[model samples]
Target chain A: MTWSEYGRLFLRHGWLMVAGAAVCGALALGLTTVQEPVFRARARISMIPGVMDWRMRDLTKELARNAVATFPSDELLAAVQDQIGLQTDAEGLRAGWDDGELIITIEAFAGDAATAGILARTAAREFHSRRSLQFTEQDFIEFIEFEIRNREPELQQIAPNVMTNVLAGLFVGFAAGLALVLMLHWRDEEWLLTRQAIEKSVPQPVLGRLRSN
Target chain B: MNTNPSSRQQDAQEQVAHELRALRASIELACHKPARSVVLLSPDNSVPTADAVWNLGLAFRTDTSSTLLADSDMEDPGLHLLADLDLAPGLRQWLEQKGQPASALAATHDHGLLVLAAGCSNEDPLQWLNTESIGWFAPALMACAERVIWRTPPLDQSPVGVLLAGSADAVLMAVRPGHTRRSRVNRAQRILAQAGIMATGTVLVES
Candidate 1:
């Protein structure tokens, strides 16, 4: 089809796309209001070697790896929960290690910013205290030290992104509407509405076109 | 700029009249010889066949040659109404009673245009159309005027329409966009082809 024909096709059925976009956009907007918002907070704790020794650096790296592996453990979660009076279970807490920075990152999610920040800060503090106690009677105590990189939790609201969800809904709705219009157009093939359509089916020449009364 | 309804209607009518005149020229050019009798057929009633025939008759009128418009579509005759003539004493009467073709013809407002209405009859028109008298009806009507134009029923709906179309010197099909179906046109074409007839050309009716 030519560009003009495409233009005509869209002109004939463009309303469907507009209506779909409108309904889907309204639905998305409505859902944003009803859905619960989620806020996220993160705290990073660095593992540093107290002495400038290769063995001590290697030990600090091993300790950081171990901390990452056990960061999401139930025992750690229970301790953090007791410290912060958390209402939710272990579902809200997560941990990861950035090897390049020798940092163990603690993240927490909650219904509000204050609780999320407190959860992340309390988890980081509890992990540091437990690791310090574990090495209090060993020689590793003079080789490793733990420092909280950010005294305050970095907080953000991450869920129920209104603009992104609404935009996605409108795009999907428009695509579906276009598909329906094309299906309907092809289904009614027997109708000869254009000169090209009529000419394709008949052998005789079209003499002239007369306007409707 | 002229938003008057009457003016718009008149403008539309003028445009239709102009297009009909162009169609008249096309028909004249398509036929090799001077076609004394031309039959107009449509795939369905949605097309304005009667209106085209009436306008073509008016367009064909000239100082030298007279044009006779006949409504042979007995099932749904409309040319007579377009010409503001009665429904009786027309082709039906001429076919039932072997009267002079001139007696059945009614003169219109135009001096060069005459009309032969689809006359009233008690019996079925198919019976009258099938008779031997219908064969010579064209020749008899041609004798009354220089040009004869017949408006028949939808070719796909009535077998009588195809039969009448076969007797004419030239055949023209009328089709309306969005209303006329491709299958119906194909069926009409098949029926005409079965009788060794083909449409000389087609007129695309916007209506």
Candidate 2:
């Protein structure tokens, strides 16, 4: 079909597209409201080498990478959970190294703000205590130190992003509605409005045309 | 005077007459031999088949040839209403009683054009569509006029149209743009083909 014909078809059925978008957007908003909100809390711990030696700095960097990797370990999570008396498993905890900062950032996700903050604080404290004990036993306590950077964990709601979900729903709904309109138009073989359409449909020749009264 | 409603009506009527004349010429050219009787059938009832039949009759009358417009669709007859004539004592009466064909024919404003309305009959009209009945009725109407136009109901709605089409010298299917469906027309054509009848051509009724 030509652009004008598509324009006419859209004009005739554009309401369906609008309705689909509205329903989907409303549904997304409704679902977001009812969904369980996840709260995230973050804590940063700086790993410093006591000596100015290059070899000590390299060892501290390696230790920081190790700390980041082991932050989400089941043993460390169990120790943190035990300290905080948290009933939930270690599934919601994540740790990463801040590039070139020699910092290990620990993040905790929970259903409530207090629980998320407590999880992050407890996890960082337990990691510091464990590393201190390991350094003392290995005779490296004089060369390395761990400092808790944030006095309080930074907390925020992370899940159920209403605006993004609603926009995505509207886009998906519009695409689905357009597909439905095209499918319906394709299925309808009865609408032979033009002379060329009629000629293509039937075997007999069209003799003459009359204007509508 | 130029912009008045009456002037517009006149212009519309002239345009319709011109279209009808062109249609009539096409029909005349398509038929190898002179078709004394032509049956016009529609696949759907929503089209203005009755008006086309009436206008085509008027177009045929312009040539000074005696033309008869017969409404054989007894089920939902409208030609009598179009001609502003009574429904009774028409084709039905003539078919049942075998009366004078002249009595059944009603003269129109045009001297050369006559209309045989679909008469009121309590009995089922399909019973009157047999070969014995049409064999008698055809010659009676043919004897009165040089050309006879039979306007039947939509073939999709009634089988009587296909039967009537089988007896006519030529058959033309009337189709209304947008209103008439492709499937209905194809089905009507298939019905005619099943009866060993092929439609001569199609008339696109814009209304």
Candidate 3:
């Protein structure tokens, strides 16, 4: 199609693009608000040498590794839920040891900050208790380290990236609107527009011209 | 610059009248003799031929007692609509049925300007045009009128237009500024030149 035809089409359907952009942008913001923000907290425990288990520490490390395999058992989660006063089924707890050498970390994520922090601490304590009973000595430190540093909240809100969401909505909406306009233009199949074009198609001297009624 | 509809319309009528007068003068000069007929063929049929023809006939009405604005376009004959003439019996019947025009010609608002409508024809107009009888029929119409202007079909749209162009003394093309394309104009001119038709020139209409 000629540029002037496209210009006419644009004038005809330009409002659609603007309306789509506005609706999509508002929808993006509304969706962000409707969905809850998630907060995550983490705690770590390490199996260290103690008085009785000091000489047999290497052998105890092996024992700790064996105990780490069942660190996040359903039973452990049930105990942590009881300690944390959780009314719901296990929804926020996750525990794992990296390569099972010596350290185990427990993480919790929830819609609220307090629950996430409580769940994390509870998981750490529950895992330590079970491992202590596995050996004769209490070598499992309660919480050797906490993930938090520099005044960071235990459960930090990590969702609803406002700027990114709005931009995505704008791009998608505009593309859809433009496609609709072009499709409409294509459907309208009138091609001839001016005197020059008609003359080129048929050899004739134009005796007169009149406005289209 | 006037945006008023009535004023704009009056200005357009005046402009068309002026152009038609100029066209009439050009045909008179090109024909160089009395009883010469000019075929008005547009590359696109949608141009305002009825109004142009009326104005053209009016331009010559004061000079001559007999001038004919013949509507030779059989397929779509609407010249009567603009000329304020009811559907009447005329030329096409004279040629096909071999009957004389048993009625008077459709007279327009202009004095000395007569309209010969395309008339009723069920046979293929193209076949009628190709017959040798077209040679005798054109001169028969010319014998009665001082100057005859035919509103023929578009040159490229139908073979009838080219045939009419062949029979007439000169071919005058009508074109609308926005509706008519330059390529179609050039192509029509080329086709007429190739077919040995005397294409007088163009009449550009603002509509």
Best by DockQ: 1
DockQ, candidate 2, comes to 0.39
Instruction: Give the alpha carbon lDDT tens digit for every residue of A23-132 in model 1.
Output: 88888889888889999999988888888688888888887888777766788788887887767677788888886777888899999999999998898888778787
Minimal lDDT window, size 10, model 2 chain B: B121-130
Error of 1 at B175 (Å): 1.8
lDDT, candidate 1, B1-207, per-residue tens = 779999998997787778777877888788877778888888878788878787677767778888999887887778778778899888898888887989999998854589999896334467677647567776788899999988887876677777777777779888887888889888888888898888888878775
CAPRI-style quality class for the chain A–B interface of candidate 1 = acceptable
Residue A137, model 1: lDDT of 64
**Model 2 segments more than 4 A misplaced:** A1-177, A180-188, A210-213, B1-7, B110-112, B121-123
The residue-by-residue lDDT of candidate 3 on A17-128, one tens digit each, is 8787888888888888887888788776655544435455665455556665665688887787778677534556665555444556667788788877777777777676
Which candidate model has the greater lDDT, 2 or 3?
Answer: 2
Q: Model 3 Cα displacement at B202 (Å)?
A: 8.9
- Candidate 1 vs candidate 3: the DockQ winner is 1
Error of 1 at A127 (Å): 16
- Candidate number with the higher TM-score (1 or 3): 1
Error of 2 at A136 (Å): 17
* TM-score against truth, every candidate: 0.64, 0.64, 0.53
Tell me the TM-score of candidate 2's A chain.
0.80
Computed on C-alphas against the true complex, the DockQ of each candidate is 0.43, 0.39, 0.25
